[model samples]
Target: MIRSLKEEIYKFIHQKNSLYGLVALVLLMIYSALTSKTNADSLISVFGAIEWIPIILIAIGSAFFAMEYSNNTILLLLYKNSERSKIYIAKFLTILLYGIVLATTSIITALLLSIVLKSRQYNLFTVIAGKTILIQLGLNILGMIIYSLFAVAMSFMLIMLIRVNAVVICIGLAWGFFGTSLSTALMKTLPTISNILKWNPLNMVFISQQLSKPHYYRVSQLSNLQLIMGTLFYSLLFAILGYLLFRRRRV
Candidate 1:
């Protein structure tokens, strides 16, 4: 498993398009900071900005697995007697690692930019200390990582089932944004079932915000522990389904 993971990591790092996403994420963070009126404002902006990270994770996940099928690389691995389960697990771990790096980069970029472009009218020390900005930063980053993993599993499942990169991406984007919102809205109409919506992967989008700012517009129905557990369950469920489909796939 370790060797497979190393191999998967090597493949991911060597992909030319991988760096582009990271660069874009950093630029977005910087821009968000630049337009902010205060350090705390920038912090909030950065946190909101990272909300789109699940889409990024989906794109990467789709492309990563799609390439293997499209290039017939999976056949080559099987020819070499590689265990399918190990390959799937390695890819999962690799995507999780990628999410960690992306989240960390976002947090670091946001913090540095906030410090550099801080508003002169605002007392930086007071805002930072009062809000416990460092702790919030950690929570935000962790939340993004969790969301990214869930997205990775979802995209991987779609990719394995569809075996088409473009379709996978389209479905991922549509569901990540529109489908989730629609579900949330519909759930609200049924007050009794609304509470169960919190367990949906899409609704967990505000997990980090709920942790750092309970008063945020989109409050979570689940407690922090419940949210975390729900996310893990969704991720695990998608991963298991993805692997099962991959095993039975013609490729």
Candidate 2:
């Protein structure tokens, strides 16, 4: 399993689409630096911004996998006696591993730029800045991993069932950009939709808006226990669905 995963990840890393994920890391750091309020705060927030970095790479993953499916390579893999589940797991793990590496790269890059340029005036040692920065990193990274996984599942669904490249990219971007709006609309409807869509990670952004204290947002609203259970439920649900679909696919 380990060797298979390693080779899968290596192939993914060497792909042109995989290189696009690096652009995400750079953009994430840039966005973090610019949006952060204080010079000192920027340092902290740049690292924190790592949390959602996986999200930026989701498009790349979708396009990559979708291409494979569209080109019939995925079918070729299956013909070689590769189990669908193993292939899906390997591809999924590769994207996730890339996310982690991307986050680390962004964090280190931001820190290095801060040191070499001394231009941002973002002092590295401010306590509030430092603490909140880490907090943001945690939030962003966790959100990205979860959301990116969402994309991975979406990729499998569309690639196998719907083969249009432009359509897939359009849908992925639409969701990536406005997904929270769907969550909000569902949450706002009159009929007890809370239980239905609370399981949706898209709701996390909307709930985040209601936060009086950013750090405590998840803890206060859902309680740590509820959040954990809900997250686990969603993750398991999507993972199972993706696996079943892949297994049952005729290609």
Candidate 3:
């Protein structure tokens, strides 16, 4: 397992997509910071780049696996490792690691931009929406991590099933961008079962919103703890399904 993980990490580090993704994320943070209209907007913009984490993870994770099959390197990987489970887990972990790197970059870039652009507006200790900026930033980061896990796992499952990177990227991006809105629309259209529907994986993506704005609980119809658990459950579920498909797939 350790050897497989090391190999996966090495591959991820050498991938051009990894560097391009990082650069794109940083540029997004700069754009968000520059376009803020007020102090509150600026502060919120500090975490704005995080909203793109899921989309970025989906693209990178799906492309990583799809590249393996397209290049016929998956056969070499299986021949060398001989343990499909190890390879799958290692690849998943590496994707999660990339998510962590992106999240870290978002936070750091946001802070630097905030200092340069709005140093006098508010400090990290400044209170906003009843919580300090630093605390809100932490919660947002946690939410991004949870959502990224689900995004990466779901992309893996989709790629394993379809073996088409472009389709997988489109599906993953649609879910990442619209899943929460779709969940909200469904709940309103079926208010009677909104309670049950609130537990859906799509609604769990609102964990950050509820965590930062406690009043958002009315919209999500779920507590922060519930959203966290639901996101984790779906993440694990998709990961298991993806692994099963990968193991059964013919090289």
TM-scores for all candidates: the values are 0.87, 0.75, 0.95
Q: Ten residues in a row with the worst lDDT in model 2?
A: 204-213
lDDT of 3 by residue, 1-251 (tens): 99999999999999999998999898877777666553654555354765788888988999999999899999899889898999999999999999999988887887777677755767778888788987887777888888889989998999999989899888877876798899999999999998889888888778755677788888888888888899899999999999999999999
Model 3 accuracy (lDDT, Cα): 0.84
RMSD of model 3 against the true structure: 1.4
**What are the clashing pairs of model 3?**
none
Question: Any runs in candidate 3 off by more than 4 Å, and if so which?
Answer: 44-47
Report the CA-based lDDT of candidate 1 relative to the real structure: 0.74
Rank by lDDT (best first):
3, 1, 2
Residue pair clashes in candidate 1:
none
Regions of model 2 farther than 4 Å from truth? 31-52, 116-125, 129-132, 135-143, 191-196, 204-220
Error of 1 at 76 (Å): 0.8
Give the distance in Å from residue 12's predicted Cα in candidate 3 to where it truly belongs: 0.9
Q: Give the TM-score of candidate 2.
A: 0.75
